[model samples]
Target: MNASPSHQPHPAEWTETQSLLPCVERDLPAGRHQFHKEQLMARIHEDLRTTTRPEPPKRRPNPFLRRTVLLPAAALALAGAVAGGFALSSGDPHGGRTALATGPALTTTVGAADAEGAPRLLDRISLAAADTSTPTPRKGQYIYIESKVASTYTSSVGDKTSVVSEELHPRQVWNSLDGKDGWLIEPGQTGDEGITLASEVVMSGAYDVLATLPTDPDALLRRIYRESDATRDHEVPRDQAAFTAIGDLLTESYPPADVSAALYKAAAKIPGVVAVDDAVDATGRHGVAIAREDGTGERTEWIFDKKTLRFLGERVVVVKAVAGSPFKVGTVVFTSAITQRAVVDANKQVPGGAS
Candidate 1:
């Protein structure tokens, strides 16, 4: 298990937010910016194709390389901090309920039934997004998101026995549209800090970058695939990596209505995409989903409101059972629901209420 991250004071006060919120900072793991940049550049170069000279590659520094080794560890920590509900061999065969050491725990509800296959659904979602009027904020504004997440893991007591554990938590994040400032708030921890915008990773949580993305579905899809390849760890499968890249963009950033619709259309073009109706988010809101199963027994779904066609959340489920795995077939390994999102003028200003 990874140790919890600690909160550190800002080296210097932020003049922009000193009046509204205190500048408490978090220690970002090194190389995070580099990793994001690599992903971004992949997409841009794929489109431009202007460079003929094979420039020397930029290698990660030794200190940052060591930090890169901790990426998986940090993932585990984030998983425990945000995810919840594990599966057991003894639980319901459908895996909606989990069997705890003490008793059976009623957990996630079963996913919704399949809808009009992937193609039709994606088309409708794209049309809806294009028709809707979600606001596009200015560069200095902030986007606030309130959400809940759950993660599942397995722990072995001995070679023969193990237990699956899951934890769920709520989170609030304020992102600067220009990508110069941000803040994260969760149970018992908060961070106020500075961050750089990666021009390459257009889908990353940077509104400025997202604004610059191509509006055409084909062009956008190509960019996403290229970027996914550029920053991928190589351990993940290609299709899965591409799908995850899209998911990250949808979940973490607020894109313009046109761009969002273009992305939906682009996603529909991806092979192996599927649709599910009646999926439930962590908040218990029922919606539809577009999903893809990674070759590794895990399936990721992006859930959306049925009527409004608005994004609701995302979930990860187990499609196959593996020995000693924390997740069983049909088990919901992770879920996150976006409760609220709005554009505000100040870092401390929330959309519907006080920060």
Candidate 2:
């Protein structure tokens, strides 16, 4: 792992007098320069809030439940469906059966087909539709959700064996676009309890909220791109200096190779996954490549379970920079492991009006 940069004191560091005083007052051109610098800093700070991504709502783990175990029958059914060409759900927890049905009509401009010959386009459409139909449990709504998570991490510097179990609670709801009518609820709590050699620790923290798209793969990609852009534009700048500092630190710590390897390892485990591809976006930024991993490894493609129209859980990777390093060190193998609770209202209007 890459270490943080040393905090060596520089002999030429600016003193308070030199940095704070107006240079023009002393009959020098530096005073005018100082004024301009101040103005620039002020503008940056002012624009930061508007430009930053919206902070995801607060989610707390549910405390009432301890461990949520998937019934053997359900597990086997899900595994079989994923291995085959279809997708499956455990259905509603309230004893109601909501079968996995065909997703809404949508189209995609990107992605390739997977190994089993399932059209990635259809998968995206399915996801978009599910996203639209799924309702997140809100403050007053009756929603049902079930999750299973497995997480492993090294202990903080002084501690040995890190483990925890937590129950997540729902906090807020956001509407999904892509033509499916439903809302996405950001769960506040984590469901998995961390286990270590000595003791089990309940890990409780906010998880990232993602917009589910209807089954159309292209539609799903569009929503993902849009949400990511919104996050970068609105949420990142709220704490501009802090985010910038973290970016700088990451650049100085790890090598590019290490970061790439970590990402590949995480991507390999997603179900129905075939390969990982890479590309440059329209703006020339380096973009991610997630393709179907065929036997030859030459064919580029995207992974999706055609039956349920849901992206395989393993394919969704969360990349976070390792603190003080230029490398990405940590990896979480599962995506659906994060708690997702949905509320179905036969009477309420769609959560948010379509854009």
State each model's CA lDDT, in order: 0.48, 0.21
Clashes (candidate 1) = 8
lDDT of 2 at 272: 45
- Tens digit of per-residue lDDT, candidate 2, span 218-263: 3433432342233222323222212111111111111122221222
Residue 319 of model 1 has an lDDT of 65
**Candidate 1 lDDT score relative to the true structure:** 0.48
CA error at residue 338 for candidate 1, angstroms? 0.4
Give RMSD (Å) of candidate 1 vs. truth.
15.2
lDDT per residue as tens, model 1, 97-148: 1211211111354564343488898788788777766667876888765555
Where model 1 places Cα greater than 4 Å from the true spot, the runs are 1-116, 156-167, 188-203, 352-355
Q: Which lDDT value does model 1 have at 140?
A: 80
Candidate 2, number of clashes: 66
Evaluated with lDDT, which candidate comes out highest?
1
Query: What TM value does model 2 have?
Result: 0.25
